[model samples]
Target: MLPKGFFHRRVVLTAGLVLGLTGSAFGAAAGNTATNKAPSSTSPVGSTNVTVADPTVPRPPGTPCTVQLFSGVAFNDFNPRPYAYAPPAGCGTRWSKVVLEADFSVTAGRQFDRTATLWLGGVNLYFGTTEEPSSTVAPSWHVERDLTDYSALLRQAGNGQALIGNVVNSTYTGVIYGSARLLFYPASILAPAAHAPDAVVPLGSDPVGNTVSLATPSSQLSKSLSLPTNVERAYLDVFVQSQNADEFWYTCVPDQYAAEVQECGGGNFREAEISIDGQPAGVAPVYPWIYSGGIDPYLWRPTTGVQTLNFMPYRVDLTPFAGVLSNGAAHQVAVNVAGANNYFSATASLLLYLDPHAKTVTGQIERNTLVGQPPTPTIGDTLTTDSSGNITGAITTQLSRHFIIAGYANTSHGRVDSTVDQTVGFGDIQTFTINATTYRQVTDQQTSSDGVSQSTVGGFVTGKYSEHMRYPLHLDVNQVTAADGSFTLATVAHQGDEKNLAHQLFGITLYSAKLSNTVDSDDTLAFDASGNLTSHSNQQSTQTFAFNDSLGGCYRTDVGSFSGAVSSYATGTGCPGQQNRLFWFTHPDGSPENGNAVLGW
Candidate 1:
């Protein structure tokens, strides 16, 4: 049964359809060591296909003790699979690093893309979506994440669940199976464990079903906790995923024009807002994530959208509120999607660091200028209709916000002041041309968040951190019905995720990095008058990823495919000296470097 507001495009003459970090440095250098690997090729009609991606996580030099969280667990129903988790004993608790790895596969058959999530101790370890399977292409893939920051939670034994909601019946026959494990790297004389969060707090629903559904701006996923009194720093890692009608939020129009353009409403703007005890704390810009079965599936054959298989959570610094949260009373932390329609799935975790020397501390919020809600967007609609009922015009929506949050905490060392200044901006423009013979829609959208945080003691700056991120998307869909009733559907899409981050201490830059990933694709589908698909052609896609850090670590890869087969591959083209290489070393102060490096991307 389709849920309310669910939008799935189906054409009857229907022939069948369609469908669609980090670690370690042990010697991080910045050059390409080898050629880029080719992407997996599409399998024949009754076989399995291997979907591939370039490796993004850097590994430390030490050997790791592995702990199996779950093995060959099948997900053929809505019930989440439960599992037991215990830290690896041999590796010791104070390890240099921790990593999570998982593998998933689906039987070759028919199935829609499903959401996948893993939770341990009520905290989200992974969140992503599966690939759609076809009669000829059963797909398999692997994903990994660095969990060093959540080491506090991993140190204790716990129970968790893996959720990959699916249905298996005579129809929708695909079955998904998965396995996951954690790798613990023990600290050594040369490579010691980095400073990790002292406490971890989860802001989610009940256990197992660890995510909350927010149907509107007023809906929130909140948790009340009695935190430690000496809290010195705090951060929240948040994830907001669009579901049901909100999946294609960037393509939606204002409510009044929904029926006119055959699109969803609520405008094309969504942002994740965070609050502390009813007061605004911070904002996280939403990324326009496209799933495997979104739009024209053919466009994502050999390469998928950026972060489609593995999502990177956005981190919101809540350090300024540390004093208020440590006042000995239970405080509430909440999250919501500002423009959620139908709904959005949300989850978050709070990380806190306490002053080791002080058993108790005090502080207060000095100033808070962040509003609870974003300003109303400027909506411009120039759509026009002729006497024949044909529609032609453009609709544009844009919004921008800027604010500052400040607070101070008294610790054993001294009184420290923390302030955060941020700016968020969003813009979406869509143009439509509709008539009896043609249906065309084009959309261009961009979202960005830029912020900086600084810590000072006695009026002297002690630390500084800055981050900048941007998401850009462009899509064009055109369909034309010929006089004989036959029709052609063509689509062109370009999507990107880009980010830059840096940290400084005592006026010296300690760490800095830059990352960019993009995908571009186009395809055409033809159907006969009987509504039967005749052919699909002009299928092409490409993905490029580039990353560099001040420590001298560098990685870059480009993969291209045509007609469902990988055709070209390259590496290190965008790195320093056009070479791909990675080597990292941590400084005594816990700052990381790829090599003896300067502070720049």
Candidate 2:
């Protein structure tokens, strides 16, 4: 099990160490650092809060050349900070490995968590939310991502922007600052350059990179592109961030009970839909990510929710449509959220792998059974109201879908046929009891996806990929008021994320892995009769992360905290033999593993 504050403290110390060792060299290399202005005299104190995630990105055995993207950029308003980017100098354009690293800090004071995004050439590189600050606690953290697949876009010079929409006033007084850089490892005899997408196409309303806002199901974010004709494989990475009334969608109710239950409408099912020239291509499940300030802020003081600091985009296999896309005509690729309520922010990018030996490839979509729209959810409710205006009842919602897409392309090697079979499911159940002096709500929700992609040449399988993912969440809230108007609020939450993946090339197992992370927390807040804040207690939280792959890479850690400080920390508890285990036996060619797949469709 993971402790609430252990991960946060560990990340803080690690970030400080990195800064201490390379601050001077990085500053000297960055000739023109972006900056709004120097911070005020009352600089924010570095925070100890951190997100629960893998602290390291497996690397090759070689030195890396660093390139500074931006440094110490301040964000206090709605404007975006623009920066210029160029390829690294010493490292050649083709690198064996590329990584993106960033550091962020917020001033100590009262402030709500804000959203942050980085975009280059109209493609989103990063999307996440900042940590909330308190009068005594200021938070700082570091994040890293493997950008080796996006090499095609990073090979050229471009202009990008970093947007951290924030509000700083007499009430909300916290300001956010950020610095980011890229590391490129040169290819050598031991570490050869890996295969990467030949072209990357951004899908959004603007060409210079920006997130599109979708207020309803009818709204769409689409892009038209004339892609290369030799495309052999294709995939799209998609992101959908819930905002406003949609933030707590899991606890929502049917439209008929919106007023009675006091919850959001449109049911509790949401998904991202992909389309190729108005034809259904694939589906991506929406993960429920809670921000630092969500619900009761005290619950996340030291530890944050899963992917709260840095989000992982869902990859949708579009290889079946590669034949249709390679026709050399301008095709419209679009993304939209199903069952959207109020609004949502969305972004996506198209990745294509070209047939190096073939100048032009031709084929057509043989079969596509996926419907353009998702099925309507089924909702059930049973409630009874008494004479005293007290209400008690339960509500449930469920939705599921299954589809298969198949196509063939005549490439330089041979006539390659590809098929994608997938299934998605979602369910939410909520129980409520409300009265004049008491209010209670409990929610249990789950979202899952299972899929298999296979490629064949002349009826013989060439590659096969399989992935299974599940997200489970539970939340309970109880509030009681005394006759004198004094009140107490108690909350408990349990969240988990699990994924298993495997890749096989010509019947040879190249990669396989399993990952699981979970967090459990509970707290209580007391208020005076006059409604002024009084005290909080019983604040406790714990987290655990376990990961293992066929490549001999294994990591496991558990930690717990109480009253906002770490209580215990342990490692290797979930590994073989119960011995602390953390190591990486990566392939010399930089093959994908764990979070990434070698045969990504």
Candidate 3:
């Protein structure tokens, strides 16, 4: 009922763990370094407050090399676009990081934002929202991650692959240009005792074949794995997709607790737990992807906000259970992914790190923090419509959503507990009658996740984050001929803002960033009796800003706006600024930020 990139942009139903970080050496070693802090009063309510934690292992030793896997091009309106990237053969085992950079060719200071996944081994590893080392956004920006934690999956003989753009149906029609690359470190350096995955086993996709069709939600999935012996630790890597993708609303930033899931039946949720052979093992947050909509894989690319096939990946440390599976026998391992009602479906694999000479895993299940499973936290919601059945005209309206989830991870050192939360989002469209033949509509949306707690471990790690996706829009229809055909949308204007914020305390280098975006545009449209777009007219201006460098924030070079074919419009010089602003709050002494003056399209 609305234009592409409008309502569809917010219907991202994918679930994920929102882990935002970047820095040359601000991280601890690969081994879970023993970890945390509590929340301050200024902290967002219901925020994740980790008391402590252990850092994961370090990157494997290898001759560092980078290879371009895929490149992006400009997209036209409502076109079906699908893209993939296959890394150079034989280099999969040497994996270190996956880097993605993107921007709009003609749009001014477009906040180059999108979500993608890296397919490695038999699992789909999520790249979530890619932010630079410091958290920033602009035309042509990039984000990267060290893949050592998942080296068991990406460092396989098959190398790695990736999927870009909306696969369900490429309705995200923007002239987006982007690239994906993988940085490889040699495989020769992995320590036989403590480094690299010794074995990997897939238990299969959820619903058996990724086709979810069951009257009742089934939460338990188990598979038997034949062992090679001497296994020391393990990781339960899993990927999940809710039939109701709107659950993506759970990860709204700036504050998920302050946001709203505007639709009545929308899915706004958090956290999915995984158990190994009926024993509690790992837990990860269910996050959101705002720019993902218009994707309906089940309906064969149906044009609607209802999403059927969208997935996010997360992992749980199963090392604590390593002792039980190292007896050189076939053991039954299972991960029961739970959510609201029976609305949970997922696939999991046990990546085993082994010691070829050691007797067996000695780690014991010393303690379990959470007991007796509970329901997920929800964002309060309210939806309203006017007499015309549209979210506009004669009837004024207001909507909001803010909710939270809280828990803790306990270790021998100190007690660790945390609270996680989110603000789904708030937006509305308005209409007024100038006459029976004239009407005007305006839209205003504001999304902020000032408080969102993904996870926290005592003395180990936990943090808070925020993201803002807000915009205001206006449209006027001065003429019409038939049933929603041959209509003239006189003018369309919008003001947009996007930003990401992450605060972390992981024992090593404490990291944080304030990344933000700014965008403004004006456009016009006309349709013929045949419902063909007869007008190629538009005028837009844009600008993106950043107060931190770690988030990949920068400014775009004005390409000047134009009025003609969408392709003929101007482009920019990508996000400009020190792309390498050192972390640890290390910007040039009192560095001056590029002002809003450099913004117009």
Candidate 4:
């Protein structure tokens, strides 16, 4: 089954496919390490300080009924993938000069968040990296020399390093079209070490795709270029791996803007090149490399085993597979990959389900396994998990049919019994329209297990308070009593007083059983300036927020805590309902996020 966040991505990418390109192309003329700085400019290209929602549409939501399980893909720092553009022939000729203003944003828990701005004339002019944390630095564009003359050779710098004519309007807006060459910097240029400081050592390989290695190992003192037959792109940029061992280092091109490069004297040295060895492995003719104001700390090429050039392609594979299915609602998808270690065949399946309107799940799943990772054992050294004998349950709101809650239970007595994983306890905030009042019902459950056998049952209830519900409501009363059995309760009213917290003075006795006479919990909620719910008051909490994305139905949540940082991951972009998922299309677009969601029994 396709994991949960795929469909929405397809939509966003599909939109990005316009004219086979994104914004404009940029270049780094030369940078100095002694006084590392971007080309001096007048006003900011576009305000790096502005906070605007992305213009791209949101993805689709995941189907609530689909069986959702954890997939192995991890979400870390976000970066823009390579893209190219071939603007209409007349678009560039229509305007003497052009400026590009683009905005990009992703949720905190997404895989990558990257954006770049570039200026171009006859050729790709230089700009800078944008949309990143401020501490990091990278190459940027400035008005060192005015736009003098436009020529063909300079515009088509032949081997990837093209020189634009001259600056015209310094600034312009609305889509500018041209034949842009989105160059993919050598893996070395996009390497993590290139951005590392003198004292530090790089931990791993480059995040970006290309690589540049010296044909023959040379010394930092050698200004003469030591040709590496392995240079992949015409411009295979490199950086000093370590400064702690030596004084300083340099490259063939100027390093005025490569802040990571160290200066020996007033100038940085470059190792000259002779004859190249390896052919361009995979270089895209016109690929897009995004840049935000500050350097993207996490942005880098995908590491490969060989130190070879892998440039962007003139035309990437953007076709979709025939096996992919799309429905209007959320669907859980699973992609089954069948192949040996090296090659594989894949097929995807879709499972659709709706979110429950309301209901709390409370029960100790004894001798069973809860869908994903087993719960941590607080006092014990080992917590075993059972992977066989499936158990599933659902939670639905009494009023609305739009939402639902589902759970997978694994029993200890399976065909191949391993260990038992039992649900300790769980609760839910049930939202439904009762009569005219909007009420939130609280329910909870708990369970214990000993690998071989286990059992548990828990429930809770709360009092009905107000008729009209605000956008961000405060924490209402909710608890589970388990002396002999378990049941939940919430504050319907104050013991005998009609006026308690809100000040409607009508005092009754403290004997009303339905009205919370004893305060079991004192929790609350916090909202943002936009009335959007931000945090909760409860000491222990697990809240989920659902939203839409380009892929279709998508969601994010804070599993626990107020002070602890919230982490979110997504699943289901293709085949829904299946346990395993594979990429049906390296580039999938248009399908709703729900269509790619997956559900497993």
Best prediction by TM-score:
1
* Cα RMSD, each candidate: 7.1, 8.8, 15.3, 31.4
Evaluated at residue 397, the lDDT of candidate 1 is: 93
Instruction: Estimate the TM-score of every prediction.
Output: 0.90, 0.88, 0.44, 0.17
**By lDDT, is 1 or 3 better?**
1
TM-score, model 4 to reference:
0.17
Error of 1 at 461 (Å): 1.2
**1 or 2, which is superior by TM-score?**
1
* Candidate 4, 1-601: lDDT as tens digits: 1111112111222222231211112221111001102222322122222111111121122211111111121212222122323332322221121222122221221111121222222122222222222221111211111111111112221222111112212121111111222211111221211111011111112221111222212211112122211111011111211111111111101223212111122121111211111111111111112121101111111100000011111111100110111112221211111101111111111111211221221111122112222221121111111243211121211111111111121212111111112112211122211111111222221111111111111211111111110111112332222233222222221100010111011221211111000111122322222222233333222222222222233222112222212122122223245121222111111111111111100
Q: What is the per-residue lDDT of model 2 for residues 50-93, given as tens digits with 9 covering 90 to 100?
A: 43434345577788899888999988998989988889886887
Order the numbered candidates by lDDT, best leading: 1, 2, 3, 4
Candidate 1 per-residue lDDT over residues 48-105, each given as its tens digit: 2333334545556789899998999999998989998888877788877777888888
What RMSD does model 1 have?
Answer: 7.1
Model 1 segments beyond 4 Å from truth? 1-54, 372-375, 574-579, 584-601
lDDT of each: 0.75, 0.73, 0.34, 0.18
Please give, for residues 44-107, the per-residue lDDT of candidate 3 as tens digits: 1221111011111123344556655555644323232333334446554534332222221212
Better of 1 and 2 by lDDT: 1
Candidate 2 lDDT score relative to the true structure: 0.73
